[model samples]
Target: MTFVTKLSFASGDRDVLAETVQELKDTLERKGAECKGPHASSPETVSVPQYKRLRAGDEFSPWRYDVYKRSMEIHGADDIARDVVARDFPDSIHVEVEVDRKKPLGHRRD
Candidate 1:
């Protein structure tokens, strides 16, 4: 069996997000891990409505921001993937990891 680790990173700051993702890719490469990519996605705009008071009588302009996302996959490098997941990241950056187990071709359940 082989394990593939998918890592997704997101942040409101595009520059910081890019820097972080590039650093992670470089580290994985240096460790000889089979990394798929640091694929980037278009920024998403998010809006939040603010109120002047607890009541709904008054309201303020909606606050808006853009979120950037990037993703990559590490193939058959459990140790490196684990290390990457365990490492601490900046508060502004969000990281998500998903592990998938793949069975060899022609394998079947008993």
Candidate 2:
């Protein structure tokens, strides 16, 4: 049976995220593992209002930041997937991984 590993990487720094994902893809491919994609989602914009302690008026501007996310799916790469999960990622980047076992057609869910 094959397993699909879904990896989601998020970071405020776009360059770092891109580089990290690219490196991961390269490593997995070099190891003869099948990597599906590093599909990028729309950048998420988060806004935070900065309020001054003394002034309660609506004079403070809100701080806005972008949170970029990239996703990839690796199939039939249990060993590589485990190594990836145990690897140390940069502090700026956040990684999430989910593993799903592939079943035969007759055993699949509707």
Candidate 3:
């Protein structure tokens, strides 16, 4: 079975989160990590205020939460995972990785 990497985060700034996600995706491609998904997907993103309230938090003192996700298939190995972990990340949020249920079309099978 193939492994994968997922970088995700929650933030109080939706625009920043959006930018980070895009930047990550671009970095993955420019650095040639064999990424896929989201190219044909449109994930539902929420604003800082809306996100807080959606999670049942008070807007006045928002608990600081937002939704952002980026996924890259690791092919039959974990090269993608190692590469992503080696990349630099912004100070505004955190990143976490996970496995993908389906193989990303962009990943090389060999």
| lDDT of each candidate versus the true structure | 0.94, 0.91, 0.58
| Among all candidates shown, the one with the greatest lDDT | 1
Instruction: For residues 1-110, write the lDDT of model 2, one tens digit per residue.
Output: 78999999999999999999999999998999999889999999999888777577655789999999999998987988889889999999999989998886777565
Query: Which clashing pairs does model 2 show?
Result: none
lDDT of 1 by residue, 2-110 (tens): 9999999999989988988999999999999999989999999999989999988688999999999999999998998999999998899999999999899999988
Candidate 1 matches the true fold with a TM-score of 0.95
**Collision count for each candidate, in order:** 0, 0, 1
After superposing candidate 3 on the true structure, give the runs of residues whose Cα lies further than 4 Å from its correct spot.
38-77, 100-110
Highest-TM-score candidate:
1
State the RMSD for candidate 2.
2.4
lDDT of 1: 0.94
Segments of candidate 1 deviating more than 4 angstroms: none
Give the TM-score (vs. native) of candidate 2.
Answer: 0.88
What's the residue-level lDDT of 108 in candidate 1? 92
